[model samples]
Target: CKTIFPNLFLIIHRNIVSTVNLACPLDLKSIALQARNAEYNPKVLSYSAVIMRIREPRTTALIFSSGKMVCTGAKSEEQSRLAARKYARVVQKLGFPVKFLDFKIQNMVGSCDVCFPIRLEARAVSWIYRMVKPRIVLLIFVSGKVVLTGTVGI
Candidate 1:
């Protein structure tokens, strides 16, 4: 579900996620051992990160040992922030001095159908010429479906 404003462009669905700094290093395996919802596999990609999930916003947080955490899959910016804070609190309660910092909304994706057919090839060329800024990535389908993603506002 997504919020809609009359003045804004059509948004079918949106994903708003945040990246936060935990301020202290973590022990991935220990976290996995302590938290029932967390899973860590050292054999997977050889990365030291704990995969965590929360059901309220139905998001996933990638908690890394380097004091960095990325939370994804929230439907709105507010939900993303709340979910991130919830995660930080969870970790803090788990005995880590997890201070929520640098909480940045990393990505928001929105899609809509124009209710008309489109020539994707022509649209792609046109969109490229239409001046894309630093962060946005867009995809246009022949069915006039559009997906736009960026770090900026939705």
Candidate 2:
């Protein structure tokens, strides 16, 4: 016999990863010096990218010389997009001709607690669960908690 618990889970998005293209090459050294909340250490990553952070959305962005940016630490898709735009705006304000292009939500991570113990041995699949969608993966624990990752959308 099997039991179904309907509406037993409420997932909270923990992190959202997104990418954006600025559509213009960036001068990392200039950005590092001119932009506030920006950090760049050539010895650290060999001048590959500049790391910028914003406090409002609490997100971090990796900005590359090719005008590519990756934003992370947002809790929702909207926040992720907003943060990316904020980053673009910062660069644009720095006198760079930047256009926000190809903003994409690369991955989302969420977790939930069911409030009951799950018997993993009974399922015989161990702890890791892969969804039909190639990008999604779930981790089920005996404590009835689940972590879902790599989802592109809600």
Candidate 3:
């Protein structure tokens, strides 16, 4: 039964990063205080944006003051969108007019092992290699660890 489809490729999605526009201004300090799962630190340069997390989809979102949100850690495209919508709803509930707009998948990452060590040195590629397909980057390691990134969808 397993040999029937030898060409079947399994792309194990490790994570999906997506972006969405709320189309309205947001106050990071207010969101952090109102949303239980949201955190914001204005003094910290690394955490300039409000970080929000959801348990249902196990995704985290970075909410900027400009109403732009970046959602990450979803296993699939649908999951990413669902998580982003959830984040947007949370903001909307905080009394900010939220409009879900320009929702797009920024990057999709998939990882797989070839089951054998790869000779990356012979390839002489840089730390990261790009796939033949446009907008696809493959990070191949010597230990047979391959990461496929820069894809918009699964």
Candidate 4:
């Protein structure tokens, strides 16, 4: 199912078993929620790492090893970056050993096609093709093989 917040989007996986998935925006409020309710913790939780990606014009995804994630849409690069830093801070304050100063940004791009028409004397003749703007993709992975994907607008 999908949940929409003011600046966050969440996709959750619900099964009556032992696996959960969450994705939300890279905002302070949303990040706090995910960090709190993602998994079962007898003691406090510590964050291993935070990763960021610039995937498109307005989309960012963040994944946590606690089986929590945040996907923020319709944001600028600066907003996304700030949100990420804030999230890392929150995790650290929760007594989790968050090492965010070691984070970095990665860029990704790809191509897409659009269709156009060619006209003849009385009928359409051929189709035309074009390339789409490049997209950026960000990935944050904590320890233990958990991958986080974040994207921000260019």
Candidate 5:
């Protein structure tokens, strides 16, 4: 069966590196001291995570001492993985045994460049997406995107 679909356009994209194992606990103090671009200040409630960024993928990583990491700012899947890997490698080089754990896309939220009015039909996409939290959401570019968290079989 052949079907026609509306042209798709992407204005911006965001991906996350769910989680990774640094293998062992990390000393944020050492990491921050080692890199000029890295920073860590627990003085701030929400700023406890060690912040790190790489220029290549242009992403930021929130590395926790518990060996979990959250990477953001990659425009594509490939770029996201590369960015995460770069973060792990950098930490590994810092004498922390880092391991590339389950690195996968958490969600892909995109907005079209077209200004025309468009309808968002969740039911239509349900068969493929299976589940979309909140059922319906209005995306208004303000630095946040929709998150579809679930496990689907291939």
Candidate 6:
């Protein structure tokens, strides 16, 4: 039987990172509401409800559909990870499970400095690398040695 039905579905998954610095006191609830109603491309099937959470006294979360999330007003990488982990847990608790997409720490201080010291950063980096497990291209900084890890998708 030949039937006319939509067979192809394109799911565009995007994750965005943003930052906000507020000078004066603001209403978090109202701000979140405004973000919730903010428009996006018409091709978007639907905009997911914005999930707002406070990472600390400064940071806030604005989560959207398809695992897209933005952590705003964070000061440090520690703060960013804290917010992202909290948001990820909340999404999981809400029964929306998504594979770890991308973990980024923006607006960070010195390139060498991190929430935790080098050891901890190495461990977390290793863990995330294993989790996402993307193809890695290694470049030797000083010597001519290279280490390649993870599986590449072709």
Q: Model-by-model lDDT, in order?
A: 0.80, 0.90, 0.86, 0.35, 0.65, 0.41
- CA RMSD of each candidate after superposition: 4.0, 3.8, 3.0, 16.3, 7.1, 19.6
* Steric clash pairs (candidate 1): none
Answer with 1 or 5, whichever has the higher lDDT: 1
**Candidate 5 error regions (>4 Å):** 1-18, 118-154
lDDT of 3 at 125: 46
Task: Give the winner by TM-score: 4 or 5.
Answer: 5
The model with the greater lDDT, 2 or 4, is: 2
Residue 92 of model 6: what lDDT? 56
Question: Residues 1-154, candidate 5, lDDT per residue (tens digit)?
Answer: 1224335433454443445666678888898899767989988747568999899888888988887888877777778888888889888898887888777666554443343333445523212234455442334322222223232111
50-70: candidate 3 lDDT, tens digit per residue = 999999899999999999999
Ranking by lDDT: 2, 3, 1, 5, 6, 4
Give the RMSD in angstroms, all C-alphas superposed, for model 2. 3.8
Displacement of the residue 120 alpha carbon in candidate 1, Å: 3.8
lDDT per residue (tens digit) for residues 25-116 in model 6: 33333334444223334244354435475625255665554345677555445556666676556455444443445565433211111122
Query: For all candidates, what are the clash counts?
Result: 0, 0, 0, 14, 0, 0
For TM-score, candidate 2 versus 6, the one ahead is 2
lDDT score for residue 131 of model 5 = 40
1-154, model 4: which lDDT tens digit per residue? 2223433423221101111132322333334455543233323436532333343333434555553435354233354455555545555555555554433334212222112222334442322233244332322122111111222222
The candidate maximizing TM-score is 2
Q: What TM-score fits each model?
A: 0.84, 0.88, 0.86, 0.31, 0.68, 0.37
lDDT of 2 by residue, 65-100 (tens): 999999999998899999999999999999999999
